[model samples]
Target chain A: MIIAVASGKGGTGKTTVATSLALVLGNRAQILDCDVEEPNCHILLKPTILTTDTVNLPVPSVDLEKCSLCGKCGEVCQFSAIVLIGKTILTFPELCHGCGSCSILCPEKAIREIPRNIGVIETGFVKDLDFVQGRIRIGEAMSPPLIREVKTKINRDKIAILDSPPGASCPVITTVKNTDFVIMVTEPTPFGLNDLEIAVEAIKGLRIPMGIVINRSDIGDSSARDFCNNNGLPLLMEIPHHRKVAEGYAQGAPLIESMPGYGHKFKKLSDDIQMIISESYEGASI
Target chain B: MKIAVTSTGKTIESAMDPRFGRAPYILIVDDNCNLIEAIDNSANVNAFRGAGIQAAKAIADRKVDMLLTGRCGPNAFTTLEAAGVKVGIEQSGTVREAVERVKKNEVSIADKPNAEAHW
Candidate 1:
């Protein structure tokens, strides 16, 4: 089953939960860090990258030689990436979404797609667990494309865990889409609860079965719990705020390895997820 | 020469808008500083992306010789420049005042984009 770990707010322990769960699942699980902008799971997992592939986006390249400034390519481009100004045709590679509309619709066929490197995808393994991640190039505004590239590395035979980026935006949507379930990590604060509500709305729209895992569950207000209770949403697990856990995380140590008995807790969490998935499958079959 | 000035309203007396891409109005004027017409630019205000390019196309379609605005992004600048439209940056005051400034050659045409892409 493909499970996505996500949070609407940043620094809410998405990496912590995803790494710990992968550790507990061991060889049975493959973890993909789809947070292309700033992937932190590598810091925790430290997988020795076996293979690296550069991700490229097909951007438009105009052949001025074969040119007719018929303005057809410009007219067909919704992105305004290409425009015919008098006899000159201007193409903005950054603005192009690589839709190939301009090339396809060009009367003169002066446009050709050129691969532009946007990011890199690395596949490796941590101990026995398969690991993959996508790191977007700096100053790249688009992360969804790279995230999609990372998802393609998912192994269907293993339990795939996707560590999604923060916010309920396009990147987050791309990471969470087509997952069997979602574990939303949130802190027990007003800010966390508000963002979690937005995330919950987004997930509900996708009709994905999701549960909340409240990180630092003891310090903040119980509003998150209350919100979950009111909404009848499942509260999967809670990781308390502890000095040792924090220090271990800072030292790039997995929670299951650093904290005593936490391996059992993560195992329980994994089993609970499996139970839910099986129950849902049974319900669907019935 | 016809010029387009980014404006906050649909009249020559309206205050000049600082933003070129998301400006509410584009007031077209003739060489004598007479108001030609105001084109609404509100459609680009909420554009998902590429507002500058769309706004530049809108102004270029009006067949204006010059653009007067507070700032122009790189994409819009290139589009306008390629269209042979001279851009006057840091334009302020009312639309009429901006037009008068342009006529008096008080606002010099920008050599490059004055602002980075905000989006």
Candidate 2:
């Protein structure tokens, strides 16, 4: 089963929950960190990477010789990545989505796709647990493609956990899509509650089974809990605000490793998720 | 020479919009500073993405010789420059005043984009 850990607001402990769950699962789980922009799971897991592969997007390269600058490529390109200016045809690889529309629709067959490196995917292991992550190059605007690349490494034999990026935008959607369940990590602040509402809507739209894990559960107003209760969403687990957890996190230690007995809590969290999924399946059949 | 000025409304009295891509209107004028027309740019303004490029294409399709706006992003600037359109940056005041300034050569032509992409 693939479970995605996501949070609408940043710093809501997505990596914390995801990494801890992986630790509890041990050899039975493989974690794919799909937060390509600012992947932080590596900070805690610190898996010794066994292999690394560069990820590239195919962008169009024009052949000036066979080309008639009919401007059709430019006209078809929605990104304005390719444009015709007088007799000059310019292609901006950064803006290209690698859709191959320009090359496919070119009348003269003058456009050829060339690979442009956007990021890298690294595969490693933390003891018996398999780990994989994608690191997007700095200044790169898009992360969905890289996130998709990381998902390709999913191991079906083991429980797969995906650490998703913040916000309910395209990157977050890409990471959470096709997962068995989504665990939304959130704090108790108003901003957290507002963004969580947006995220809940997005997940509901995808028709996925989801539960909330309120991080720092005791600090803020009871509105987050109230919102979940009114919506009939399950409150999976709560990690209280504690200085030891904070210091351990700052020192790049997994909560399960630093907090001693916290591994049992994460194991319980995974068991609850499994129970919810099986119950939903039974409900759907009935 | 026909010039386009990003505007907030469909009249010469409209304030010059600082934004090029999301501008509501494009006030067109001739060399004599006469009001030609104000083209509604609401379509590009409401676009999900690529507003800057779409707006640039819209203005370029009008065959305008120059563009007057507060800022031009890199993508829009490249498209405008490629189409041989001169850009006047940091433009403010009413549409008519901007046109008068352009005619008097009081606006500085942008050699490179003043803002990053998606600005």
Candidate 3:
């Protein structure tokens, strides 16, 4: 089963929960970090990367030699990445979505696609657990492409636990899409609750079964729990505020290593998620 | 020489638009400041990205010798330069006033983009 660990607000312990889940599952799981912008799974897991694949988006390259400034290339481009201005054909590579429309529609066939490096996908092994992460090239605005590349590394035979980027944007959606269940990590504070609500709304639109895991559950008000109760979302786990957990995280230690007792808790969380998925499928069939 | 002034309205009497790419209208005028055409730029104005580049292309297609606007971004500036169109940026007032300023060589043509890209 493919499960995505996501949160709308940053610093809500998504990486913490994700890493722990992967650790608990061990050889039975492959953790894919889809947070291309800032992947922290590697920091926790410290996987020795076996292979690094550079991901590229096919941007348009114009051959002015074969040249006719037919304006069709400009007309077909929605992002205005390629435009025919007077006798000059200008291409802004940064604005290109790598849609290849400009090249395909060019009657003169003056446009061809060239590889533009957007990011890299690194695959490695963390002990018995398989590890994969995508890191976007610095200053690269587009990350959905790279996130999609990371998801391609998902092993169907193993339980894929994806550590999604923070937010309800395209990157998070791309990571969460096609998952069997989503475990949304959140805090009990107002900021966490607000963003979690937004994220839950996005997940609801996708019609995916999701549950909440409230980190630092002891400090903040009970609003997060109240929200889950009102929305019929299962409160999967509540990790109380703990100094040791924080220090261990800062030292790049996985949650399971910091607090060995939580290993069983994470395992239970996975089992609960599995049961929910099965029940949903049974309900759908009936 | 045909000149285009970014404006908020169709006529030369209208206020000059400070924005280049997202300007609502572009009023084309002759050397003597006679209104030739008013090109609606709503498409570029509402564009999600690369608004300046598309707007520059539209103006270049009109075969304008000069463009008088509030500011020019890098992509738009580069496009206009490639089209051999002189850009006179940071001109504000009525469209007619901007045209008159350029006619008298009051506003200097920019060598590089005066502003960052809108995108």
Native contacts recovered, in order, as a fraction for each? 0.50, 0.35, 0.92
List the pairs of residues colliding in candidate 2.
none
lDDT of 3 by residue, A198-241 (tens): 99999898888999999999987999999999999999999998
Clashes of 1: 0
Q: In candidate 1, how many Å is residue A163 off?
A: 0.5
| TM-score of every candidate | 0.95, 0.91, 0.98
What lDDT tens digits, residue by residue, belong to model 1 across residues A170-189?
Answer: 99999999998999999999
- Per-candidate DockQ values are 0.63, 0.44, 0.84
Over 4 Å off, model 1: none
Model 1: chain A TM-score against the true structure: 0.98
List model 1 lDDT by residue over B5-75, tens digit each: 99999888899999999998988999777889888888888886678888887777778899999999999
Question: Model 2 segments beyond 4 Å from truth?
Answer: B9-15, B34-38, B59-63, B94-96
| TM-score, model 1 to reference | 0.95
Docking class of 1: medium
User: Each model's RMSD to truth, in Å?
Assistant: 1.6, 2.4, 1.2
Q: Residue by residue across A1-286, what tens digits does model 2's lDDT show?
A: 9999999899999999999999899999999999999999999999999999999999999999999889899889987788776667878888889999999999999999999999999999999999999999999887889999999999999999999999999999999999989999999999999999999998888888999999999998998899889999999988899999999999999999888888888999999999999998899999
Alpha-carbon lDDT, every model:
0.90, 0.91, 0.92
Model 2 CA lDDT for position B21: 91
lDDT of 3 at A278: 99
